[model samples]
Target: MRTYSLDDVYETRKRRDSWWTVYFVDPVACRVALPVANRTRMTPNGLTVLSLVLGMVSAACFAANHLIAGAGFFYLSFMIDCVDGKIARLKGTGTPFGLWLDYVGDRIRVVLCAGGLAYGQYALTGDVSYVVLGAAVAVLDLFRYVNAPQMKRVREAVREERQEPDLLADADPLLGPDPLLGPDPLLGPDPLLHPDPLTGPDPLPGQESERAGLGRTSRPRAFFRLFRRLNRFLARHRVRSHLVSGIEFHAAVFVIAPIAGAWALIPLAALSGLLLLANEVFLVYRMWLFTRRHGAGSPQESREHVLV
Candidate 1:
């Protein structure tokens, strides 16, 4: 049998991850993953399958009104889900099929758990609100997953445009020079002076100064600056800035709510959903402002800003 260290397990972990996983899940998961990686021939796909099975068991527990048991099983399932990715990164055994399976399995688990919790509560109390709550949980979970990728694509597109040589030239008058490249003396004088044929003539002096002022004043608001500082602190601990993300949402609904008992479930879930929605909307608005400010150019020039 091969030997594996805790350090090795940590190395396989994501550089930036949800705060819930970083604080609540990863500590125990890394320990679990180390032994499994060393002692078992189980592949990442195998762990994913096990996680899915555990999730089904959790749903069954919830349906039976075994709330505590259900919460325990759900947490275990999620921990295993975390472990599989760690093992995949550690062993280089990740497959495209495994990725698809992981994604599909997560969706199925959320749907089943939501249905189970709602039905169980409704069965006990004969309240239709339980059903509504369950539906809301499932819908919100799906919405987050669906929307996150599209938002990520938009951010990436903006980044790509910023990096393109031609698009950068077009954006320079408004957004200033690329911080990474600094002034390229090799390009011969400044493009602001010579002006690229494709990009057209330079802006008026007043226009240039106005844009510069706009860029200067476009510094993030105080709240966002504080948020960024908090993220920087979290980064030191290998956690991402999204404090209440999908993982936390699931935890609030399935784990925390159940532990707090039936009375607390709806309020807790609602609050979690609202926070998640607010965070997402804030991100989308920021992206919109970024595009508006930096994306003022021809359609051909605009298309250049896509990242992978």
Candidate 2:
């Protein structure tokens, strides 16, 4: 068996990650994962299961109105959650099942904790608003997770579409005409064989004449320039632009809110939810602008382009 130092565990940390994880969690998690990586025989899957169990215990504590203890357990569970991924990367024992288990476990923990905290508070004060707050937290978390992957796919597809013409042009001189479409009189002399100098190559689809300028209003352009600068600064620090992500949301609702007492939970959770929604909406708007500039067309067109 190989032994790993604290440095080795730190090396497994994600380069671009939420601010909460980078500053608050990684320092402690690396220290904990160090010994587990060196001496323990536990696998990543085992650690994930343990984390889930701790989360359950945290929820139970919340249910009993043990706010301080519940907050402690929730933080500990999240620390363990961070450690599982570190161990997986350090040992190269990661599996598809492990990823799925980690994701599902996270969702379950959020649901349970929300319900427990809300129920405990409602039971104590008889306010139904707590119940609604709990549902809002769970639903927002789920919606973010569900939409993220599809948005990622759309971004990737748009990028590929923008690059496709360049790819084909580069290959045409060496590969000649595609064999299946050997000669099409209707399409005229193959553009590859007899290129027109005056017109230049047909502009990349959806790009047309606006490829150079990106057809952006001055205000949006300036905003994006500032955004890029901010992104670059964040990247330098190995943090992501999304400062208030799902991880931060959970930390705020479960750890900070509980410590602040029942009165603070609803307000803190609401603020966190709003921040999360703002970040998501900003991302969606960026994607919309990107697709418009790149000529991604419709969802069906993007799918067809990707398939091709």
Candidate 3:
């Protein structure tokens, strides 16, 4: 993994090599070109707004049956989306407000894009397959939003509980004043969507409890216990933490499912949702532990000085 810094924010090539190159690399270069092309200059949010506009235009193109044009515009819009953050970070103006805007804008972009695709599908094939796909994507997008706080909670829990140096965790760019995990006041009443005052919940059903107790009873849970032990051994030997984001799980499902057909994708999507649910459940448990052990407080207050 590559480490990032405020200085590297403006350094196009450096950001390119970070594993997030999938999203940020080309977009940063493209947005950086905006200033070089005209000395008048463009702010990161301006770029983000421009990108949002372009994304809308691209959606329109898709709705108009200009599939290639729409795809091209969407691609560019995504690039700008990526660039704006890089610019913000580079310029040392990556505020929480900007972060919130970025997250909200991403949802809007996904909705519009999916709507356009659904419309385009109807216009072209006269079948609602594309529309259904679009709807599925829209649903997934919402699920993604709802999942953020839970994922953040889990990562925070891992950081607090895991006994390792966690250089990878420490080097994370999404930490400090602008943590990737924060209470999104905008997400509204969905308890799972944002951190709320923790309250205890009922224990898991008997089977899950039994599964968890397997090792306690016999020193091994199941066949997977060996792998878990091996993983622990590796982490202990290497002195690093294993923190996998659930987004990676969705990423794989998103790419694989659609190509595999509704039958395949639907189940994968369901499974992914289950994983997110499980992640959230774990987060709740973690929150309880954190609060009880270290004085209860609002999530914002707990990590006011830190980031995820």
Taken over the whole model, the C-alpha lDDT of each candidate is 0.73, 0.74, 0.51
lDDT of 3: 0.51
> Given candidate 2, what's the lDDT at residue 62?
91
Per-prediction TM-score to the true structure, in the order listed: 0.78, 0.80, 0.53
Worst 10 residues of 2 by lDDT: 179-188
Question: Candidate 1: worst 10 consecutive residues by lDDT?
Answer: 179-188
What are the per-residue Cα lDDT tens digits for candidate 1 across 167-250? 322112222332212122112123324432222344566765554465544344333435545555666676655567778899
In model 1, what is the error at residue 96, expressed in angstroms?
Answer: 1.6
- Of the two candidates 1 and 3, the one with more favorable TM-score, higher being better, is 1
Give candidate 2 misplaced runs (Cα > 4 Å): 160-216, 297-299, 303-308
Q: On a 0 to 100 scale, what is the lDDT of residue 191 in model 2?
A: 35
Candidate 1: count of backbone clashes, pairs at least 3 residues apart or interchain = 1
Best by TM-score: 2
Tens-place lDDT per residue, model 3, 150-261, is 5455445444554333221222243242244332211112222222222222225665555566465333234324434443343333221112223333333333443454
